[model samples]
Target: MAVGFAVLLTVGCGQGPQAQFSVRDTTEELLSPAQKAVKKALDDGFGTPHELVAWQRLPVNYGGVHGAVGEVLADGKGITAKWEGDAAGVTAGAPLLWISGARAAESTSVDSVGSFDAKTKTLTWSGAAEPAPAAGDKLVIGFGQTLKTGRMVYMKNCMHCHGVAGDGAGPTAKYLNPLPRDYRSGVFKFTSTLTPEKPTRDDLTRVVKYGIPGTYMPSFLWLGGKETESVVEYVRWLSMRGEFEKRLDDDLSGDFSQKAIEESAEKALAEFKAAKADEKPEKPRSAGDLKKEAVAKFTNETDGYEKTEFPGVIDDTANFLAQGWTHGEDPESLILPSVPRVPDDAASRERGRRMYLSDKGKCYTCHGIQGRGDGAATEDFWKKPGSDEVYERRGLHDAWGHPLMPRNLTLGQYRGGRRPLDVFRRIYAGIKGTPMPGFGRTALKDEEIWDVVNFVMSLQYQSAPAPAKPAEHVAESK
Candidate 1:
C-alpha cells in the first residue's frame, strides 16, 4: 500500500514543514539580468512541490485533463468550458489549474463538477477562485496532481537524503559513503541507454523498485506500480529542470561572467583612448568620462542580450530537453547485445581474466589486479574534467567530484545488478558519469565482452587471497 499523504507530510517533524522546493546554489552575482529572467520563468512553470504547474513546455507526463474557460458565471464563482483528454479524471475534489488570463498558472481545488452537456460540449465547476476564470482562459483540471502526489512520496522517502532540489545534499547525505545522486546534473551512473543519453523510465523504475545492492539506497518493492510510476515521473521532471538551469548558466556565462564584464570594460576604454589619440584635444577625455562611457557600453550590450536573444536561447534549451527526453524512450537509444552471453565455463572465465589484466581492458588500473579495488592509480593525482585544476586528494572521483573507489569484484555486490546481461550492459556502455569505459564494438567484440562478464561473475567464489604488494612499493612504505 502507498503511504498516506498526511502521515508522509510530517514524517520527520513535530510540526510539518511547509512544502517548498529549494533553488540551486548559483549565486545571483554570477547571473546576468537575462539569466535571472530565465530562472524566474522556470520557477513559475515548475512551481513549488505543492503548487505544481504542468508547464506544457516540458516532456513530463502530468496526467490530467485540460481545457479553456468558455464563459464566466454571472455570480463570479464558476465557469463552463470544453474539456479535452481524460475527461473522466476531472471529477469533484480534483484541482483546477488556471493557465491563462488574470489568475494564470494558479490552481485551486474543485468543490463540485457539473455533468458534461454533450450538446454544448462543456462542463461547469464551482469554488475555483474568488474571481472566476475569464473566457478563453486555458486551464487544466486534475493536472499535475501526479507531481504533487510524487512530491509527497519523495519527501517522505527520498528527500532526507536527496534534498528538495535533488542536489543530493540532504541532511543525512554528508554522512553516507557514496552520496545520493544529484539529479540536477541529469546524469545517472547506471543505465541501459547509450553513454550520451539519459536513463529511460524503465531504468529508473528498476532502480527504485530494486535498490542498489551494496549502497544505502534501499528497495521500495512494496510501493504499488502507480506510486512507483508517479515518483519516477517526478524524478525525471526534477532532472529535466536541473538540466535546463545548467544549460542556461552555461550559455549566459560566456558573455555575463565577471571576467567578461571586465574585459568588455577594458576593451571599451582602449577604443576610446585610441579614438581620442587621433583627436589630439588640449585636454583629452577625462578618466571619469572614459569610465562612464565604458560602463554605459557594457550596460547596453547586456541589456540587448537580455531583451533580444535570451528568450530564444531559453526556448531552444527547452526544445532540446524535450526532444532529448522524448528520444530517450526510443528503442534506438537502448544498448542491445548483438550476441548471447558466452557460456560461463572455466575457459570463458580465464579468457575474461586475461581481458581484465590486459592494457586493452585496463580494469586493473582502478580495480586492483586481483579484483580487490586497491589499484595504484587511486594514490595518483588526477586532473578534474574540463579544467586543469588537480584534485586536492588522491583517488578516483565521479562526475560529481565525490571520491569513488572502484568496485571490489570479490565482494560479489554489483550496484547495477548482478545478472549477466546487466554486467554485459555495464561493459557495453561503460558506467555513465564514471571512469568505467565501455568495451563495446570498438574495444571488444560481443563474445569477448560476455567472457569478461563471466570472469567478473566468478570473482565472488574464488577463495584465493589478493596478491602481495611489489618489493619497491613495500620498501617505500617502510
Candidate 2:
C-alpha cells in the first residue's frame, strides 16, 4: 500500500509507464470519480489483500480534462493512484476524501467546499477490549483510518488544554490552577517511579488507561483499548515532534551565547538533557522520609519548596500542594482542594432533601440515602486487579488533596464549596473529570439546577425531636 497521502490529484495516468490500457468503454460503465479511483486501484493491483483506502473524495464528474494527462475523465470517472510496487492493506473505509470534477461543457472546475472525516473506522465499529464484534463488512483499518482516529482523539481529549500542537499553551491554560503539562518541556510528571529515563509507551498507556489520579485528566477507559493504544501512540509521536520544536525554538532564542551556539547542536542538546535528568524523576520516598523532609522542607529558609510542590504547601495562599516525594497506600494523601461541611440553610435543605430521594436526581444511589458517601454503590463493592478483596475505593480527591467523600448533605460540607453559586457551578460544570456528570448537558435546566443547589444548601436544617412512639410508651408504662 502506498503509505502517504497528497493534497493534489495530479496522478498522471497518461504520463506513467503503466499508462491506462484501453479501458473498455462499457455503456453502463459510468463510475464516480471515487469509484474510478477504486477501479484504477483495483485494475492496477489495489484490490483485496491490499484494500482501497480513499484519503478523500474525488469530484463526481471530471469530463472536461480530456486534454489533461492525470485529470479524472467524464461524469462517473475517478482518478486512481498506483503504488510504486506491491503493497499491504489499505485501511478500511478510508477517511472521508474530497473529490473534484471539471465541467467539460463549461470548461472549468469547482473547489472542494466541504469535508468531514469518518468518526470511527468501519472495522472497529463493533467494539474493543474483549473482541471485535460484528460490524459492517465495509469497515477497514490502516493509514487513513489511523489518521482520522488520531485527529478525533486530539479534538476530544487534548485540544482544550494540550493545544492543537500538543503544547501546554491551550486556550484554557491561563485559568487553570496548576498549569497544563508543557509537553514541549519534555518533563513528564509521572513516569514509572522504577525507571529513571523518560516514561515508556506503557507508562503513557497506564496514564491513558487509568488516567492521572489528581488532575483534570479524565479516564477514557470507556473508550476502550484500541482507541487508547492509538491515542498513546499518537501522543508519543506528538511528544517527539514537540521536542523537535523545542529545539528549534531554543536555537532561535537568544539564550544561546555566540560561543555556545557555535558548538555542535549535539553537544548543546546532550547537556540540556543531562542537566534536566535528575529534576525529571522523583522516586517515591517512604512515609518516614516525607515526614522528616516535610519538617525540614517547611522551614521558611527552605521556602517550603525544598521537596516538591503539592497544594496548600505554600503558606498564606489560597493555593497549595504537598511537599516532597511522598508515596503511600493511603488514598487521602494526595493533592486536593480541602472542603468543609455545609453550614445550616433551612429552606434550601428541604428542597435538597426531596431531590436526594427523587428517582430523577438519584443522588442516593452512590452517595447513600443519608448523603453519607457510604451508599450501596460503595459499601462493599470493589474494582481490583483480578482479586476477591475489594479495594472498595474510587480514586477521587478534593481541593485539600484528601479522599473526596460525597457531600454528606446532612453534614452540609460540599466539596465544591457550600456557597449557593459554588454549588450551582458544580451542578452546572459537574467537576470536569469525574463520575459526577452535569445535568445541564441533558434535560435538566438552569433553574432546576438552582433548585437542587438550593436544596443542597438547605441540608443543615435542624428540627425539634418528634414525640415518643406508642410502642415505646406502652413499654414505659408497663
Candidate 3:
C-alpha cells in the first residue's frame, strides 16, 4: 500500500493564505433583486465556512457564553458584563462574541481583565467597540470553535472530494464513477437506520473509519478520536446549513424567481397597453416600473417572512434534523435478524438459489440471471421521482439521479461491508438513497433472507455459476 500527502500552500511571498467557502450553484443572473436579498440575509446569518456564525437556534453546540452587558467604559477599551454562564475557564485571550445591540455579529478577544471579579464585572479588549457595548447588550464568547476545528480537519482531509460546502462538487469529484455523496441532501446510502431516518453519528463514523468498499472513499482509521468526532460534527453542521439554504430557497423562489418578475412585468405591460388603446391618457409603464413594483411587492410580502416566518422555518428545520439523527440511534430504528442465520450448507444455498430465481425475491431483475449485474433493468427507462416523466438515461438511478448499476454479486465485493450482518442489514433496511428496496418484515421472512444471503455469498466461489434446473425452480426467472 502507498500513502500520498497533499500539501496545499498559497505561494504568496509575503501574505498568508486565506480561504473562503464557495456559494451554491445558483447564479446571480438567474436571481432577481428579491432573491439576492434573501441570499444576503442567509449569508449574514450563517456566514461563510471560514468566518462561521454560531446561530443559537441550531442544534450545533458552538460552545460559548450568553452574557449581557453591564456598562460601557468611558475610555475606548472594553465594557463590564454580567456573564450569564460561568466564565471560570475562560483565559485572558479568549473570544468575546457580541450577540446584540450595536456590537451584534461581532467578536473581540480578551486583552486583559486582571482577575475574575464577582462584585465588579469588567472586560478589557484589544480594540474599542465603536458603539460601545451598551447596558444589556447580549454577547457570546468562545463560540464556533468546534465548527472551526471541524472545518480545519475537513479541509485538510476530506475537502478534495466532499467540497468546502459538503456539496460533493470538489475538484476531483467529476472524475469518480460513483459520484461523491452530497451531504446537502442529508441522505446517506449505507445507514443502519430504518427507512426515512437520517444516519446516526456511528453510521458516519463507521463510513469514515472503514470507508466504503469498491469506491474511492478510502479508510481513514488513522484519524485520532477527537479528529473523528470533530469531522462528524462538522459534516452534520454543513448538512444542516445546506438543508436550511435549500428550504429557504424553496420558500422564497416562488415570488423571487426571475420568471416571476418577468411574468409580473408582462402583466403590467399588457394592462398599460390595454389602457392606452382605450383612449385614456394613462401613463405608459416601462419594464423598470414593473420591476420596481415587483421588488416592492416582494419586500412587503417577504418582510413578514424575514421577521416572523423565517425564524420559525429555521427552528422547524433544526428540529427536524435533530429528530431524524436522534431517532436513528434509537434501538427501534435498527435492523436485526429475528433468528440466527440458517446453516450455510447445500440445502440452504439451494433454497436461496430457488428464491433468487423466483418471483418473490426477483433479485435477477437487477443482478442478472447469472449475477453479473448486467440485468435487463439496466436497459430499461425509470421514472423520475414524484413525476410521470422518465429519466433521460437508460438505467437504474439512485436518489442522487446518477445512473446506477446494481451490485455484481459474482465479483464478491459489497460496498456496505462483506460481513454477514452488514449484508443482512443491507437487505433488511435497504440501502438508503438507492433503488435497493428493503425486504425486512414486509416482504421476506428472516429465514428466507438468510437463505438469500447464503446464496449470494456462494456466487463468487463457484467456478461457472448457473441457475437451478427446471423442476427445482419454484418461480419464473427474470
User: Which candidate gets the maximum TM-score versus the true structure?
Assistant: 1
Ranking by TM-score: 1, 3, 2
What would the per-residue lDDT of candidate 2 be over residues 442-464, giving only the tens digit for each residue? 53555556667666554455342
lDDT accuracy of residue 25 in candidate 1: 51
Model 2 Cα displacement at 419 (Å)? Answer: 36
Task: Give residue 450's error in model 2 in angstroms.
Answer: 50
Model 3 clash tally, residue pairs: 1
Q: Residue pairs in steric clash, candidate 1?
A: none
On a 0 to 1 TM-score scale, where does candidate 1 land against the true structure?
0.76
Instruction: Enumerate residue pairs that collide in model 3.
Output: 99-139
Window of ten residues with lowest summed lDDT in model 3: 1-10
Of candidates 3 and 2, the better by lDDT: 3
Tens digits of per-residue lDDT for model 3 on 1-478? Answer: 0111111111222222235555554424224654566566556556765456655555565545557878877785666778777876445656655556665533332222333455567776545446566788766566565566667778888888988788888889999979988888888888877897877778888989999889999898999986887788788878877776666666666655666657766886677767756675556566566566656665565464455565576557666766776777788888778999999999998888887777777788888888889777999999999999999999899888898899999989988878888888888888888898888887789999999999999999987897554334653442
How many residue pairs clash (N, CA or C atoms closer than 3 angstroms) in each of the candidate models, in the order given?
0, 44, 1
Q: Where in model 3 is the C-alpha error above 4 Å? A: 1-18, 26-34, 61-143, 259-294, 301-308, 468-478
Whole-model lDDT values for every prediction? 0.74, 0.40, 0.72
**Looking at model 1, which ten-residue stretch has the lowest summed lDDT?**
1-10
